[model samples]
Target: MPNNKPVNGQKTPSFFDLIDQTPPPPVLELDSKPGTRRLAKLRAAWKASWEEGGFLYQRWEEVLQARHGSWHEVATWIKAAALFGGLSLIVMMVDAAGDIASATLKGLSAAPATGAGDGGGLWGTVAHPVQVFLADQAAHLAVAPAALYAFWQLAGLLGLIGGFLGNAGPRITWVLFGIGTLATIWSAAPAGGRAAATGLAALMWALASIFALRGLTLRPIVHNHPPQYQFNAALHLHATIPAPTPASDDFGDETDNIHPLQR
Candidate 1:
């Protein structure tokens, strides 16, 4: 009797007593159990939740908003372009003057034995100075004009290539300037004209290059200004919308049946 009967007995072990004897394993340790498989199911559910939320779409919209807002920031492209153009013009003038000085000096001292050689007279004195001045000025004019034309040609050519390539890398302006410099050098190939023209072209190109570098360094200003709301407001104020007056006859009663013109 003593062996068979339980001390302070309940009829059998209750659910609470059994739970107390053998508690559930911890959450972290549940993954190690063959029967549990909690972590695997949680991971699958998490992936499903993320997919339902359209995470990629949300990321793209964020990027779009940033770009759109940035467009509204003050644009300096026009100012930069105008500055570059002005500097280029000034450089062209300077280069022309330098070429003129160099050519005049060379002409005075080193006469190249022209077709007209005289024994001695007023004609030689008068004609020689006049001829030299005219020739040197003409040569100086040649420098700027030729360089202009050559760069223009190169711009057109590279513009085509740039169009095809789509996105040329950063420092695109530098690349174009380099190409222009090469073209200027190539165009001034003939001997005497070459030296003066190349020197002047080099000076002009250097100044332009400096400006172009500044343009490149600055963030590109895009023309993406939103349509002016003031214009729309003005239109709304000025424009009159006709109110529907009471229609005469049976058409008023059949208003629901009547179809307005489909725009």
Candidate 2:
């Protein structure tokens, strides 16, 4: 964004006011998975989350920038997708190889222990429960990477690509969450009361839900307030207040700084 401040005589709304005015992105309530119509659910979740400002999005953006300076560029994200695909293939190959090695070792051990005839091959090997179990587990292990790539990892990549250009949503979401959290704590003051305990419990549940499942984190009640109000009232405490720069005397005077420790 350019640094053109509003000219004189033009009033500008504060960030919080803008947050109150802005509507969250559209969302789908269904659960999602790969190759299903439910995939729309993932799209909705990411869109909604990207819109709601928070520290999580900031950290992810930092990571994206630090590793790939051009993270904001489409070409960079595509390259990332390619790298992830290559790694997934390598992981799948290794998993399959390990399964094969384990099966071979187990088969050799079983053959000697059981003395159940030599080289009868597939049927003979599967005749043992141990072999059957290994084969079944191997089947699962073999497909694990491919499944993760097709579903979760691929979904994450898409989310990154389609993410909001700014962190405004998460920022506003967190700001509201912070105000609600402080109010909750203040109301629950006096250490060991039922109100305090109850508030704490709700806070934990709300946090777990917010982290495990993405969405707006705060809900309070009023005639025309947002949806956060419909849920637990006192549960959203998070922030990003920048620290002030150090003054010369913020630390003890340097004149006597070295003497005390040495003495």
Candidate 3:
């Protein structure tokens, strides 16, 4: 039978037809299947992202245009900047090394003090501080290059991050630096020189740690300053509990007197 309830003078709709025509009751799926829902959404997003001329394609186009266009213009600039940085580092290192080497060479070449305080108390006292200063300077000079070189190692690690380099190469570099730092620390002498050498070792150690840990600690840092949050003064919270919440009647008086049969 057709749906014939006077409006169109058609035959009455059969029970089964009416049932079939009715929309299904919205499913009340109470199960909180977060993983299923999340996975489904992720799959849909992935597919949509890859759709012809979609978000992924548009991003690729933008990147390609930038890389092929402005990138070339700045290519020489990048190389120039890098070259200048490298030359500057080399010059500084060489100057530092030369100063220390020349000072120490002169000291070593100086013939033993003649006349009075030769290899004795007064002369030793006078020369000790000067020798300390020179030793300190040399170690400090070594530290300068060591620090920059460690930073350079970290920079090369960018290749690892960018997927251009493999784990083996960086790992090897880290191992070599680590061993070298250990050796330097072991052989270093004099208080000032040792202190500066320690700094170099520390830098190398930091670099090695960064490489070993895969720079996970270098994640983008987000700084949030919520209006109600205070970082400096609020760090060490000094909260005191209320002097016992004054007792209050939480329940009504009617509950004070009740009988099982009252209901």
Reference-based TM-score of each model? 0.19, 0.19, 0.19
Local distance difference test, each candidate = 0.47, 0.44, 0.49
Record all residue pairs in model 1 with backbone atoms less than 3 Å apart, i.e. clashing.
none
Number of the top lDDT candidate: 3
Off by over 4 Å in 2: 1-74, 113-263
**Residue by residue across 1-263, what tens digits does model 3's lDDT show?**
23233324544343334334444333338844766655555555555545554445444554556556664544343557668999999999999999986675455344332222232453333333333333444566754423333343344354334322336565556556466544545453345555555555566466546546463444789998677965675556789987877665746566765557654
Give the CA lDDT, 0 to 100, for residue 62 in model 3. 49
Q: Model 2: what TM-score?
A: 0.19
Top-down lDDT ranking: 3, 1, 2
Q: What lDDT would candidate 1 get against the real structure?
A: 0.47
- How good is model 3 by TM-score? 0.19
Across 1-263, the per-residue lDDT of candidate 1 in tens digits comes to 01122325623332233333433435575357655644444444444323422333333444556555554442344346557999999999999989986675455335443323341353333223323333444466754323333333345445444533443442374466455544544453345545554555556555554544443435677899887664443433477789999756755666676778898
